[model samples]
Target: MIKIAIADDNSFLIKTAQEKLSFFDLAVKLIAVDGKDLIDKLEINHNIDLILMDIEMPEMNGIEATNFIKNKYPHIKILMLTVFDNDENIFNAIKAGADGYLLKEINPKDLHQGILETLNGGAAMHPSIAFKTLKLLRNPQDFENRECQEEIKLSTREIEVLEQLSKGLNYNTIADNLILSPSTVRKHIENIYAKLQVHNKLEAVQKAKSNNLI
Candidate 1:
């Protein structure tokens, strides 16, 4: 049986992946919740044949894991199984040395076939993903616009928090002004940072301003 590794933050998704591979001659040898976890596990047991990697997670993401694994364990195959089918994610995963790109919605048979094809050195991809890849290649200019054109959804409260953040207001002051507790304000800011995909106050504010979210 081929040894398989699954890297995803959600336990449900991990279990689903295992169920999909249940009937095949593949064994789920290891499971990791994030990219850092996957790397640490691989350090102990590098015998995994293929890894089903998810793109978004808490500590580290699949693209980063794929890059690191490709550098350290060139023989191991990585198939990105994610829900994100955006142009940026697709190209980034490809550049990170992912052997295949399949959405999480794939059925059992297709997922198995994708895995087998990837193990055989084939670049398996979802049909929609393949079409998008061709379109990206044909119109390279679309890559930049596709990312920016997508609307960044934020709650009304999140936007208010962002606006307060942009004014250089401290968490306490913002909370007082908005009639919220300090810890609630802090949580709102955390959500804002996550939604904007920014780390610091400056970055979050700047991204919100750039995207016109604030």
Candidate 2:
């Protein structure tokens, strides 16, 4: 039997997915409340073949969880089963290594077909999402910029600090230029690094410049 795990924050949605899959000859191995809950349960029982992941969840989001699961359990297939079909969500889910993307409103027969297609090394994407994916592939730079804008949102102070840092200014010099304390400058730098997902000053400046953040 094809063992499956469903991860959705809403209990009603989880039940709905369960009912949809009930028509198939698959087994519902577990139903998790959210991304973090799914990871925890998988630690104990990860014998499932696939996971129906929701995008927005408490503790950890689906994209983050999918990245982690793909890294740790590369054998398991992840199908993003979410209501959100936005460009950012779709691009991020694909980048996180989801095997398929299906809308929550999909009928049982199509849902079952999607699951099987995903297991058989074929992507099961909604037609609209498939069109977006093709556009993304055609113009990756545009999608990359869009994805960067969505993920990295910096405050004005953070931008100012990054600008100073880009000019080879130390924390104290940045504080002097911005008329803020050295500690405050340091805090702003920390926030910038976190938002930009960078380690040091050089990487932060490079990322900020590439994304047009500063």
Give candidate 1 misplaced runs (Cα > 4 Å): 145-214
Over 1-214, each residue of candidate 2 has an lDDT whose tens digit, in order, gives: 9999999889999999999999989999998888889999999988989999999999999999999999999999999999999888988899999999999999999999999999999999999999999998789899878777778888888888899999998888888999999999988888888888889999999989988888
Q: Name the candidate that leads on lDDT.
A: 2
Tell me the number of clashing residue pairs for each predicted model. Answer: 0, 0
Task: List lDDT for all candidates, in order.
Answer: 0.91, 0.92
Worst 10 residues of 1 by lDDT: 142-151
- Show where candidate 2 strays beyond 4 Å: 148-214
lDDT of 1 by residue, 121-189 (tens): 999999999998888878776676556536567889888888898899999999999999999999988
Candidate 1 clashing pairs?
Answer: none
Per-residue lDDT value at 172 in model 2: 84
